[model samples]
Target: MAAKAALPPHSPGIATGAGWARLRPRGGGAMRGYRYEALDGARALAAQVVLVSHGLGMAFFPVHSPGAAAAEWFGRLAVMVFFSLSGFVIATSLSRLVASDGSRFGVPYAVHRIARIWPPLVLAILVTFAVGWLGQNGLPLLTKTGDAYRLDAVAFLRGITLTFAPGDATFVIDRALWSLRQEVYLYAIAALAALAFAGRGARRVLAGGAVVGLVILTADRFFYLQSLALFAAGAAAAHFGGRERLRALARAPWLGPATLCLLGAPLLFVVRPGFIDAMSDGAGFLAYQAALGIPVALCLLGLAIGDGPAARAAARWSWAAAFSYTLYVIHVPVMTLVFSLRAHLDLAPGLAGTVATLLLALLGAEAVSCAAALVVERPALFRRILFRLLAATGLARPAVQAAPSI
Candidate 1:
């Protein structure tokens, strides 16, 4: 519990080179400090979006129900947002590693990533199992079944490796492990992208080509590419953006409204003609998603371009933002259990168990996630172990220089 409580907020700041070096080049002096607070706030917002979407689904529809056209469309869009957010955060974090190490090819680089992601995930699985046990044994929450066989320790060990073969969807604890696998792949690709591109134009060209290939392949195999594309955009921004230009763009009059329009159009058109065609299958789906990328990318770009009131507010709460990863890890199980209990409550129809379940799941996941962060995730000691495994798995490289002093 203490581990969870002491967890740091989510602040994805500029990655200075290793060991207290300056972020700018040796002669580039007196630049503005990187905003850690704003980055953390962005992470918090992304996590909240995911939580809210999950809450809506669990409360309003069966896990598989498509709902009305509008509902179905929104659900799919919510998932797109999730993928895009993952890309942004991953790219940002990887940039930090690259800046810190001066190379993306060593042990410490990979270790940092594993330490950042796995602790909360492991805790989530353990806690979720506990919840499942309680629900199944008639301790508190009602469950869907009594005979579901909890996977054995061996199965869990296998999942920890995340090497499940194709067509294998079995995850004993955290069903979300599949997404994590995709995330790992994207990180690797991004690292390679950093290593491969020696010039800005080449990086852009390569990334553009990759995005096109991804659209054509559409193999669920390359679902990670979708995230990779968004990540590439951020990476490109980092590589190309200058402080003066970012500041100038921040003042653009129409940026805010245009961003809103792009994001809002899909929601507004949920019931309109060709809406399903746009949101659903085939070329329409591709076009709709590409359009969505516009807003998602702009929102992130806005963060860099301006330090407006919204950005300032986000920075203010950055310290409290650390629990997003923990919350993400635990929320699914908490919500699953909550949804399973609906039948037992005898609630009237249209009362969508959503509100109550959301309130409880939010509160519960937060409390528990915080505890895990403090006790399990935050210890500086376990970081050693986490890094070693990730390095062993070829996930990252070592730092080439001391990290830049903040």
Candidate 2:
């Protein structure tokens, strides 16, 4: 457990927080930081939270609704963790890419990006359409013959593009895909951020901090912007500090606990039915936005400092991390189907079923996502292309290269 909590050995091709260090090699070849397995484990935990949240929704509709809502409010913290971790992980990788060869960030990065994101996403979309088709019993859109298309072409395209410009119903592959749209935006923002911070020394850190603060203050409307800030923070921590700093902090420990408290603070304002209902729709939206940022920062800090048994357990589970993204993409529709089965079976929708169903759904999503990763997602060439195109288009950073493993 202690070994698990300790930071993974640094390596090349991963992102960095510090802009000061330049690679050096004994044999005239440059050295690089390696992937940290522990972080991946942390990501898997976040994905599970998202899964549990969706599962609760399934169980809530039929049984006790109030508890479900409470679970969702707390569980939804995973979104913040996802955003922050995205920033941290991406920033870390981008920093390393710049350190290696800033211009090398072309085709290869795109392939990595596509490989990491698209396959699972596409499969999830297929699952949605397939299930809708099956459930509709041949009726288009799952409605009567004369009724409107349920998973119509327009909705599918809108979701694929994630433009959300149409103001249509927010259903597609999964309701959670809204976060994917935001994630795309964050990817762009993180790239630009990486470019801005590729230089060495104090200015890079200050600029990074300023960018994060700027995004935090101004990115209220678009959740993607907030995610960029969180990623920036992670990138900053990785580049600036080392394992020693993390270990030293763990010795003291309060920082992690305190950050958790801060993360949980805003929830108090809006978690209650009265509070949620009391606020105007706009106010509630604002409150939720605030929660994502603070909590993300807190969670990242906890991962850094809390090397206790629980944190160690998370690190051990890090190998399961690659599937987090895929699991996240597919879990919702999977849950919808699973719960639909529960309904058909006349299973009691009590807490037990809800808990059991959540666990089973997670296991199922993990098994399927692992297969997707091994099959469609693991192809390195495609991801590199996607990352490069995103960089060239100024959608992300030209310096941020994609990792083959990702």
Candidate 3:
């Protein structure tokens, strides 16, 4: 993993009542203070929370589950956080690349992004296929046609390429694939922006324009474009909220808790019956999602700014952060398999059953995800292979430097 640059010292350190120290950065530095170390663990925790919420929603329908409403709302919020954080991280990294050599969309950057996303994604797809094949007779959770699991070669290929269309039912293997597509699209846009704007001033102008473009394009189209606004929000944060600004925000005693309360506010409405309907009809779902991005962006900013013991405590989950992508990609299939087993055994339905199912699914998914990360997601193993392939095909320069491990 790449070592993040340290924050510049500007404001004096302030001690919070809870023994946490707040350090703010000063302006006029070399612009090397933007780092992601504080946000890694928080991102991991958010991803895990998303997995848990998905498991709960899958195991117990919202209509039947007591906490399904909260879980559903949490799942959406977590994804938004993921997008915002991704934007921040990508923007920071791209700025570093540009600073290093003034090459924004180089072969190295492209290769690194591919290596980062494709391996775990491909492996997860294969695992999903295997689960679908083996559990065809029993896996009731997956969409099926006739007597076998529904597997379309075209849709699978589209998914592999991250080009699957929105509202496509072909993603039965893993509904989470949709977000991955959006992520890839955002990467492409970022790469273009980086390439088009070499100077710092030009990049700032591009970022501002991109934010406005995202909002305008996202109107009434909540599926993917709407999500881009969160990415733009993150980019804005990276552009304007330097280490000093972020650290100052982090110093606030109530910021973290306040962000949590803001995130939780939607639960009150989500818990109500027909809340989904209300959102779709009355609130204009896509518009509401765009609105929701505001608080989610704030949460991401809070997480990035936070430091001291609280940040360190979160960073302790670095292992989870390392395997978060694998977990996100494969959890659905693993959970589906667990649900199949539960059905095969005819577990009685109630609180106990639901708890057992949820626990089993979570444990199974974590175990599988960890194994996949160890075997295939490790950059040391897969990146070398990818580099060799790229080199042989002349897609990458022979002397291209290895990208910093994420």
Candidate 4:
């Protein structure tokens, strides 16, 4: 979810004061000494899982089955992985900037975060808009035009800026954007925490107040409140992951394996979403989020430090992770396009056709995600573009590529 890169050179830490304006990500997401290939793999796995789960949901659309609920659960499980992994990776990245005895968001931090996250995200939003507009106007390729396909300008602004009130029922341009919204809140809290911890003063007081304000505001939403715990747990997990005592604790590299589906079906059976209205996916649907975050965080910590079969498999899938962020962000539109054509597909007459449609949807989404990644996500072009723009504005110089650090 954090999608940060243009990666820092293995330097002392992020620059501050005047130097902050010049910070730029140069090398790919690499750090000197060690590489978290496992983390990359986990990202790939989570993104793919979400894509497949959504595909499954579309396959069984207009029908309700244990499998359908199970599919939704799997997607939620993958979401937990994304949020947890995001926390871990973000904290790890924050380590460099914050390690210098507490830090505030210097210009470098803003530049890094904006450059890393906004480009691909904006592209995805635009693409979603285009796709949604066509569908809303009866393009025949977007059947399920929930909030995502609605071409409403106010919603677009709210979605892009993440201005929706905590737990507001308003959906974003893409359903996938919900996590991004949550991620924004997470980033704000983390930033304020760092600011609060910086050299003691009234500044800390202001930050502390902001934190309290954030907490009180988010408390209105189930996910908004519980996510703080998950995020903190993930941050703590990152800090402890490097400890010798925790080194061997991460043996299970895989987070939501196929075996977990057995549990999801049973769990969703007990969890219904009607009180807050099924359309909004209220408290009952979100109840498992924090609970799932704990295990997901642990499993990801294991993956980050393990060498088991699952870890090895994850390492091999590194290429897919390159586009994981792009895939996750843009998937709603790709899925909409694919599923729209599902009813039009002439693969077969019965169950086989349904199955084929599902598979095709998944494949189509992946294929499009890959293409979009090449254009936007790959090589961290977004960062480079921002860097260039900054340099043009005299806010930065060409970055000196360095060995990737977290």
Candidate 5:
């Protein structure tokens, strides 16, 4: 997610020599009247929390294991938060781009999206391959399954392409990537909106229509439709969140706490008998995810405008937010490695083993994430070295201007 102030001072649109000017609000629209500033810290903090929950679920609390139901529930909630936040951030960024540059924002928006998502994704694929190779070579990292560590070139290609259909057996590799596929679709939808809709009102209509369409057509495909709905919820927020009424609601002291309670309440059901079973039933899982999205969207709105102490604290740790994506994509493979080691270590199966394993996984994931950030996520240094290599080989000449810093 792009991090910048949630609200910044409003400025009139600027013409960029092209037909379109910057994306400024037209007429007396609700978005035009509201100011925005950077909300990077909050966005990052939320993402990090999701990563932590996912890590805990994988490392300390496998769902099939006894006493792990709560962890599994927490992981599910964290994913809901992630999808909601993804929608919000993408919508917010697109709104800002449109307001600043009008139609001309399309190319830059696409470039920014590509830059933000692809680098870490490439690194993740490589990491997944390495981990799979290890597991195949007598590493006890993964559970023995027909597909586990069976490195068919075709399967590897499918993984990197992220082309598996929702129910395809090949989709299991790096299960977290499923959300990334949804995100890509959302990005395309957002891009289409940018290209086709000239006004904020029109874009809002598009977003609303998407929610309705997805609900009508794919509701039974909960994983797909729910994400689209959440994205639409975020887009709606971007379009109308600035209205005086909504702003007031956002600032209401009860809003933040209420949203938290709504999000947390589902966890209580994790320990209840038949809760998981109910969710597993046809349509039941879909309904649960849809219901869960309501509060997730509300939480996004609260964070968008909230100035609570918690929000402020989250904002302060923006660096963590920067690493959030890498942490997320890398954690699963790292956890697999941890699990493999645990098997050999003959670790006890109680709280002590769980805690120890959790710590190890967390630390390993963080280390890999940090390295990825330095090498792949922020590639300026790598680019510089590449430039030097090219120059050495007489393949290119140095420009008078130093390469613009990222």
Candidate 6:
């Protein structure tokens, strides 16, 4: 038993005050002020690991080599973790907002989400475009898709807003923005659902209609639905005492070691016949990714609730986690640019050249991402100043803090 994880904390209680209903499992998984440091480490670790993966080989190395294969697998696993963790973070943050200010959905939610994804994204796009146009590749507007971007206006708008910008299913400036596009739509659908679940009447009806419309619009799109299922699984785990359940399942000590293989094996068996082909097809790839998320959710649930050594150990990663998103969105352009300019350097060919480029790219990307994260992601002073300015000007409302930094 995890003490009091009685109800699922996924959603917020509608009523306020002392009489508010429980949102966790039957008195088993009570939250202790939303402190999950392990997730911070996990989130940053995922991004950094993927960055390392790309740094090792930006799809330029031999695909079938053992090192490349292992790198790719780790990349897949990290992405799976990233999605589930993101979902958990977003849901928990929303629940926290509702608990504090009592709005089902409002400015804080919209602002936090928008502010989190957009500023850095726009900056990344601009940075990518500038580096491509001025530093190197001065290609025409509609050049064929490759490393650097020709800056498709439609793609940029699509990446910024989930609007129907034709020719935006993929991002030219930064290929990393594709999954981000999926995440934006996921945020939209989830937000609408929260609105519908809030107080009743015409408002709820409109929210429901919006959700239906969103579903219909995004149904056939790439991994949209499957990713939602994975995200909701994370949300469910957070709200529904997944930690308590994890403890129950981990009653036997052996269960802990088994969990690693539990997560790793599914991809080996299910998506074997070329991961690329599976990824292009809608259901199977994301479905496998969703399946992969199961154990990740469990692992996250355990870490979020447990007081064991491994869970607490992740606290070290909290620092890196703070800027993980910045690292993720910008690393691609930063990396691709360095890689493209490799021929200019007087480095050795073969192993030495690859190693040199990887080191330079990785080092540069990390430095830039860290600096960007400081300014954009967690400028505590900046955020405080903004809040005070808003409050003074009468625009400030709920003090809805973001999800404890990353």
lDDT of each: 0.52, 0.55, 0.62, 0.61, 0.59, 0.61
The TM-score ranking, best first, is 6, 3, 4, 5, 2, 1
**Total clashing pairs for each candidate:** 27, 37, 1, 7, 23, 21
Instruction: Please write out the lDDT profile of model 4 over residues 187-304, one tens digit for every residue.
Output: 7787776666553577778888999999998887646766676677676666556555444455543344633553354454524533223313556545555665566666666666
Q: TM-score: which candidate is best? A: 6
Of candidate 6, the 10-residue stretch with the lowest lDDT total is: 1-10
What lDDT would candidate 2 get against the real structure? 0.55
Candidate 5's TM-score reads 0.76
lDDT for model 1: 0.52
The reply for model 4, stretches above 4 Å from the true place, is 1-34, 61-64, 99-105, 140-155, 164-173, 251-288, 344-349, 378-380, 384-406
Ranking by lDDT: 3, 6, 4, 5, 2, 1
Q: Report the lDDT tens digits of candidate 5 across residue range 1-406.
A: 3221133334222223322233332333434432322245655565566556666666555455434666555555666666666666666566556655565455445545555676787778778777777766776565323254345676666666667543332354466677777777677776666555544566557655764564566555537776776666766665566566765666677766777786667666666666555544437565667666655555556555666675566557755655777777767777767867787677758778878888887788888898777766754444455556656776534641132222
Q: lDDT of model 6 at residue 56?
A: 69
**Cα lDDT for residue 379, candidate 1:** 31
Q: What is the TM-score of each candidate against the true structure?
A: 0.70, 0.70, 0.79, 0.78, 0.76, 0.80
| Candidate 6 structure, TM-score to reference | 0.80
Against the true structure, what is every candidate's RMSD? 6.8, 7.4, 7.2, 6.3, 6.3, 5.6
lDDT of 2 at 101: 52
lDDT of 3: 0.62
Worst 10 residues of 1 by lDDT: 1-10
Best by lDDT: 3
